[model samples]
Target: MQNNRIRLLMLFITLLLPGIAMAASNAKENYGYYCVQCHGMKGNGMGLNIKDMSVQPRDHTDAKAMGARSDDEIFKVIKEGGQSISKSVLMPPWGDTFSDEEIHDLVKYLRSLCNCKLGG
Candidate 1:
């Protein structure tokens, strides 16, 4: 019975790993498509649009800054625009463009970019 449980657990992990990898890949792709223009390819906030913009984009790679924000705050800003978080108006609302799951994925992606978490 223990061996059977181990086999089941292994099977579960094998199936789940691919989905997790896919989610990460999709998040990266989404970032490239929707965020790279302003956040930069490296998430350093040095996109081409900066030259014409008044306010600078937040650097996703800034571990200190990103770590200060909670996951919910990130999701709200991404979904409802920066104004929702009392930030720049230039950050447009993407609620219409992405579903809640996609936004959650994006939050995770942002966390990965910063390589930090709240209070860390």
Candidate 2:
């Protein structure tokens, strides 16, 4: 019975791992296509548009800062724009552009970039 359970768990992981990897890849691509203009190619908040912007973009690579923000906050900011959280209005909303799943993927990608988790 235990062996069967183990096999099932292994199979589940095997099936799920690829989807996780694919989500991450798609998130990266989405970021490149949509976010790179302001977030920068390196996720360092040094994008091409910074010179014309009044407020600087958030640095996704800042683990300490990123860790302070919960995943939900990130999702809301991405979907509703930074103004939704009383942050910089310069960050525009992508609610019409990206699906909720894509926004979740983006939150995951940002976490990966910072290598940190909230309240950790």
Q: Tens digit of lDDT per residue, candidate 2, span 1-120?
A: 999999999999999999999999999999999898898999999999999999989999999999999999999999999899999999999999999999999999999999999964
Candidate with best TM-score:
1
Query: Looking at model 1, which ten-residue stretch has the lowest summed lDDT?
Result: 111-120
Clashing pairs in 2: none
Candidate 2 local accuracy as lDDT?
0.95
Q: Lowest lDDT 10-mer window, candidate 2?
A: 111-120
lDDT on C-alpha atoms for all candidate structures? 0.94, 0.95
TM-score of each: 0.92, 0.86
Name the best candidate (by lDDT): 2
Q: Candidate 1 regions off by >4 Å?
A: 1-3
The positional error of residue 112 in candidate 2, measured at the CA in angstroms, is 0.6
Instruction: Compute the lDDT of residue 11 as modeled in candidate 2.
Output: 100
